[model samples]
Target: MRLSRYFLPVLKETPAEAQIVSHRYMLRAGMIKQASAGIYSWLPLGFKVLRKLENIVHEEQVRAGHIPMLMPTLQSADLWRESGRYDGYGEEMLRMQDRHGRDMLFSPTAEEMFTDVFRSHVKSYKDLPLTLYQIQWKFRDEIRPRFGVMRGREFLMKDGYNFDQSKEDALHAYNRHLVSYLRTYERMGLQAIPMRADSGPIGGDYTHEFLVLAETGESEVFYDSEITDLKFGDREIDFDSVEQCQAVLEEFTSRYARTDETHDEAVFNALPEERRRVARGIEVGQIFYFGTQYSEALGATVQTPDGTSVPVHMGSHGIGVSRLLGAIIEASHDDKGIIWPEGVTPFHCGIVNLKQGDEAADGACEALYGSLTALGLEPLYDDRNERAGGKFATMDLIGLPWRITVGPRGLKNGVVELTCRRTGESEELPPEQAVAKVAEIYAGI
Candidate 1:
């Protein structure tokens, strides 16, 4: 992508409404524009990153044996009524009437709709272990929606539902989701701790919210500091093996961790003084083992071996797909701008033509860009006729993981400057070596 042709309308000054670093940077970077209070239109760069996050969620969910499907943004109010939650869900749910005067809602969640789908076609225990998910836009009318995408009224999310014939099987599905979520967040360069959390309106006795600790987070959390030391890394696991999934669940959750809503002071106090810590957390995902709550309400039952109809054990898991961008920025950015992790960066690296019209510099940048792109990598080339400082500032603001600076001075010495965004470190190497180094850095991710 060439900067001269790109539609990045980066701002020179931060908007007064942006109260946090992510919000300010997102606005200044022109990734999103406010459409209304608490609503936004994702610009090209923002949409690219959003799609990247969505793809990662899909890969991890499918890797864990879950099927992908799409559901409508608007749903009949009858489903919520049947589940006895239409009136109970409160104002956050956008309830309205269609042209026919039928009650409708912009779905805040799809629990009731998914239950209706299950009861309509799935009738036997043979299909009991099925897990289905969708990445879709959801709306919850927040009275005071702030913090950009972090607490927006409309956002993208990946929500999955699991149906099982027995309680034990349902619990295994829950464990599988936990393992998958750990991988998903890790791939996005985040360490989201799974903390015991209150289920709230979702209504579940067992639930865990994956939170990334940031000072700007909304949730107050108490946890064992040692939990931060754990990493999913490259370990292999059989998602279908119940014991293997259960073992991971225990390994990650054995420590003391809970949000303030479910915090047990006694249990927290029992931890070694050095290990106990309190902080704020931004919730990125959650898993719930709600058993028969929705199934019983919606008559989503299956016939067992005994020829008896029974409500299926069920659970819902979710990842805040769009909000993750904010969380990542909050956790990873420095004072300059967002430092996108290689796994989710919009472009693999950037090409800066320090002397835009100079023949040697232009040729070097063009060659480097071609080399990176031919290797199946994306490079953002700042080919605009602009000052060196302005081009460098834009590259830093957009925060590509790596940048290659081509100039007549460097080319005369048979070298180009390759810089790391996160470390603010640079190395002078031949043009091919700069391209090779960037490719090598991103190969594993």
Candidate 2:
């Protein structure tokens, strides 16, 4: 991707409405533009990152033995009515009438719709352990939608629903989701602590919200300090093994962690004083184990071998796909801009021609770009006829994980500078070696 041809409309002055770091940077970087009070238009760069996050979510879910499918953004109000939640869901749901005067809603959640599909087709316990998910746009008319994508009225989300024949099986599905979510967040360079949280309108007695701690986060959280050291790095997982998934669930949740919604002051105080820590966190995902909550309401029952019909146990899990970008930026950015983790960066590497239009500098950058692209890597080349400082600033603002700096002086010395965005460190090496280094770093990711 060449900067000269790209549609990145970066702003020099920060927008006044951006009250948080994520919002400020997102606006100034030209990743998003306000479409309404709480909605946004994801620009090309923003859209690219959004899609990257969506893909990661899909990969993790599928790896956990969940099936992927698409659901409509608009659904019939009849499903909600059938579940006895149409009136109970309140104003956050954007309710309206179609041309035929039928009640409709922009889907805030798909629990009811999924249950309807289940009851209509799945009649036997044979399909009991099925888990289906979709990455789709959702709307939840926030009363005061602030904070860019973090608390937007409209956003993208990965919502999954599981149906099992028994309570035990549903709980295992819940554990599976927790295991997958840990790996998913870790891959994006985030440490999202799984904290006990109130289910809210989702309605589950068992739930955990994954939170990435940041000073600017919206949720006030109390947790054990030791939880910070836990990492799910490169560990092999057997998603189909119930025992393996349950072990992971117990290991990660053994420590004390809870959000403000479910805070137990007495329990928190019982821990050693030194081990307790209180801070803010941005929620990125959640898992629930509500046995028969939606299934019972929507008549989603399956037949057992003994010829008995029973409501299937069910649970819903969600990852705020679009909101994750804000959370990542809040947790990873520095004064310069967002420092995208290699796993989720829109572009793998950036090519900067310090002396653009100079024959040697141009040739070196072009060669680097070609080599990276040929290797199935996306490298954003700052090919515009701009000053070195401006080009460098843009690279820093956009935050590709690695960058190659090509100039007449460096090229004359038979090398180019490879810089890491997170470390802000640079080393000069031959062009091929620099490309190899970047590729090596991402290959591991």
Scored by CA lDDT, what does every candidate get? Answer: 0.94, 0.93
In candidate 2, what are the lDDT values of residues 216-252, reduced to their tens digit? 9999999999999999988999988999998899889
Clashes of each: 0, 0
What are the models' TM-scores?
A: 0.99, 0.98
Give every collision pair in model 1: none
Report the CA-based lDDT of candidate 1 relative to the real structure.
0.94
Q: Which 10 residues in a row give candidate 2 its minimum summed lDDT?
A: 436-445
| Model 2 CA deviation exceeding 4 Å by range | none
The model with the greatest lDDT is 1
